[model samples]
Target: MCVAHASGAPPSASTKAKSRPCPESPTPSSLRPMTRPAPPRSGSWTARPPCAAVLRSSATTQCKNLGPCTSGCAQGAKSSTDITYWPVALRAGVELRTRCRVREITVNADGMADGVWYYDEDGEEHHQRAEVVVLACNGVGTPRILLNSTSPEFPDSLANSSGLVGKNLMFHPVGFVQGLFEDRLDSHMGPQGCCMLSNEFYETDPERDFVRGYMMQIVRGGVWPWSTAMLGARSGTIPWGPGHHEAFARRFDHTANIGILCEDLPEEHNTVTLDPELVDSDGIPAPKITYTLSENSRAMLEHGVARAKEAMLAAGAIEVTGGGPARQAGWHLLGTARMGDDPETSVVNSWGRSHDVKNLFIVDGSIFVTSGGVNPTSTIQALALYIADTMKKNLANLFD
Candidate 1:
């Protein structure tokens, strides 16, 4: 397993592919009891009688574009850049620019946002005054924009009344373990990753020594015999060319491996700040992230390594190697402007609106209350939609 260091965030393990036989029936785990879709009526339960149970099944396992293929190994999903599906929004005349950079947000005397100041490629400054400003630049960019936008009314920084503009940063520690199996498993034919997950160790209890949960990245892929030889077998046991190919073929048939992905808790010390000395090519303050794995995160990694090794052994792996340590600067970057019920503790409300600035809203991973042991993209999208609904309904009150 190769652990690559990323800047500003930790990559999510959710993107990894899982290969398995397509089940004729829906998996029980896929059926979640959703809050029953209610009727449009504003009245109580009497106005909405429950309909028949909906079986939440996954879409057909075969790639629709590729004929009669049972394997979901083809690109998991695809979204076209053109012809966006949100037609209601397009008809509403939402203006979007391709490469506009907002340099700062201008505020009024009443502490309300008046307009946004941006610089285009020609170094020309432009302003777009609005009754409200919704900041959706996401984690790292969001904080950087806020810290850079300072006025006399907001001398310290825009919407930083709690002195927590760029703090409480967190990311995940990812590690991988690979094992050679015996048999002709044809790793390249199906999905290079796994379709099923073993969440046996997902929740960390007091009985366990770790403070956080570690997820497994099950994957199967092609590996040559020479690659295995260079990796070195268990206890320095080396095999010659033909012997190596035989062993690799045997292992590849039922080759099962797991990667470790552990969550990183928010720490005030792990922060993003403006490097006073370092400026980017744009002559703006570049974001300087000062962070390291916390004691809790380190403990989680150690616990994950142990658990992963055990799982490999249980799967009948003849050898397991390279499943340990947290790499530097992971990609799951979160926190900074965390939302909470209290204005004193958090920057945004549960609805993701600024407590101090009524007209300013932040909706992105920046407002994540906590980084759960899953990919944040789905959750972030859900939160954004939720906040957008809130804003649409309360626009009049918010602007006033």
Candidate 2:
């Protein structure tokens, strides 16, 4: 159930260091006894500095002219079904288990998988002789699992004769704008958001600067000072206290925020390799991600921001701001064990079956041919359903 949006490693010590009070901590008198400012929001943007000068000031970050900041999407917007479907399937006799990392898939002389060997959480060796095995682990995990699963006949990894196991990782490079307004915007409290969506620039064929198109999203609430600082907000003469709160409230009341998500082209360099020196608590090597912001991504982000600002101003934003220099954003992984008709060029068939192992299947974001311009969870669920149906039709052939 880990969706496209749920990506990346835990924050490192360096990334977490920014949480120390930024000269902006509330005064001792203003501090509530047990309350603390919400832990600075985490994930991709959490690694940056918190000073307004470093990020951006709260004022300009919460402008009304800024289209929806966090309001366009429903606060409760979620894929609940995706979360529980597999477990529900398990209860209905689908046979699900975890912590059992595959070590090898025993293949018949005919190049078909007959069973798999793995280690349990206790490091106990065991085997699952199955007519079929499916790999639904996300993009990065799937490739590692495949490469780790070496066998005698195949010599290389299972279904990896083509040598295209781990390549082409992708995610959207996102940017946002926050602006200050003259009214209380109620930045928080509602279902995270539910407001505006602009696809005006979703698909641009122009070879101008960027290789991909970007989409815009808006939220009703204004941006927080810490978040602004991360986005390059500057410090100002604005005083803090009741005046600050009042100013923030007024701005929040009128504020709307806009965000742009542009496509990042898939490249072999953005790879996920195993860390030989550092293993996880389970003793499995941790996945080491090596990513860099490509020029194509940079161009898309810059152009997307310019287009977003223009739209915000047209939509009644009193002020418009831009964000950028696009970092190596994570999440939305795809094209690791890519799919193709030719077994020599890909890992799985169009139906996500291992070409060398008819009894094995891989159904997840890992098999994507191309990472499209949308949150991939919806499509992932649709694909799971499609693969499940394919399994049903081929169930008899699988065991034979």
User: Highest lDDT: which candidate?
Assistant: 1
- CA lDDT of every candidate: 0.59, 0.57
> Across residues 80-160, which tens digit of lDDT does each residue of candidate 1 receive?
112222333556896666567787788988888888988677767789898778898766778888898888889888888
Query: Candidate 2: which stretches are off by over 4 Å?
Result: 1-78, 82-87, 95-110, 114-126, 183-195, 219-255, 325-328
Q: Residue 350 of model 2: what lDDT?
A: 77
Tally clashes: model 1: 21
> How much does each candidate deviate from the true structure in C-alpha RMSD?
11.5, 14.1
lDDT of 2 by residue, 50-169 (tens): 111112222122112222223332221222432335445666797656677765567777777778777887888788886677787788888877776666677767677787777777
lDDT score, residue 241, model 2?
A: 44
Worst 10 residues of 2 by lDDT: 25-34
